[model samples]
Target: MKALKKSIYAEYDVHDAFQKIVLLEMQSYDGTKKQQLKAFLEDMQRSGCISGMISQFIYHADCKKFYIEHLDDLEDIRKEIEDCLGEAVKDRYGLPHYTFMCWLCFEEYCYDIYRNSFE
Candidate 1:
């Protein structure tokens, strides 16, 4: 598992201060990718990481991708997902090749822009 490129949607960043959107792509296997992704999402819900935050879980079967919108810290959510994937790998669970994209928030974008300009 690895993380892919990051992106930012200005509207979401400005309007939704406490939330973020993420795209996760997983390699398909035996047509069970959706089920596996749902299970992982359930695990996240049960573990209290996404207790009241997750707003959406959309799966695109044709591309084996998921779009998740949640109100949790972006880095924290990414770490949790990576940790779960690591565990799955260790257990030899149907490890689907995966990648994650974390969209930046307004404040984050400002900071990044400032830093880049200075550098």
Candidate 2:
């Protein structure tokens, strides 16, 4: 994990890259956030490419806030997310050891990380 974090840090400034990942993880469980993501995940799981699924999500997230009229500051943040997702997919995948159900369960794990980070 340290190696992965370092590699992502090299590609995107450490602060921005980590922040987005943390933010995504955090919001992933927020009630409203979960509702939004539930819809996306239903569609995403059909793709069957764990890496691509994660990448597309990160891609859309990086670009999401910027689509708002007053959220230009998010553009750079979005770009960084895209870069990380690109790198994560290039090397990683849905953990094959885990069943799809288990993999989906891991999203809750991510939410845990985000929650812990904030505390």
Could you give candidate 1's per-residue lDDT for residues 9-50 as a string of tens digits? 233432243222212322222335444433433334343211
Error at 99, model 2, angstroms:
14
Can you write out model 2's per-residue Cα lDDT over 1-119, one digit (the tens) per residue? 32223332233242344335434543544455544444433433444334544542334343243234223323343445457568422214443322232233233334333333323
Question: What stretches of model 1 exceed 4 Å from their correct place?
Answer: 1-31, 50-119
Report the lDDT of model 2 for residue 51: 55
Judging by TM-score against the true structure, name the best candidate: 2
Question: What is the lDDT of every predicted structure here?
Answer: 0.30, 0.37
Q: Over the full model, what C-alpha lDDT does candidate 1 score relative to the true structure?
A: 0.30
| Candidate 1: pairs in clash | none
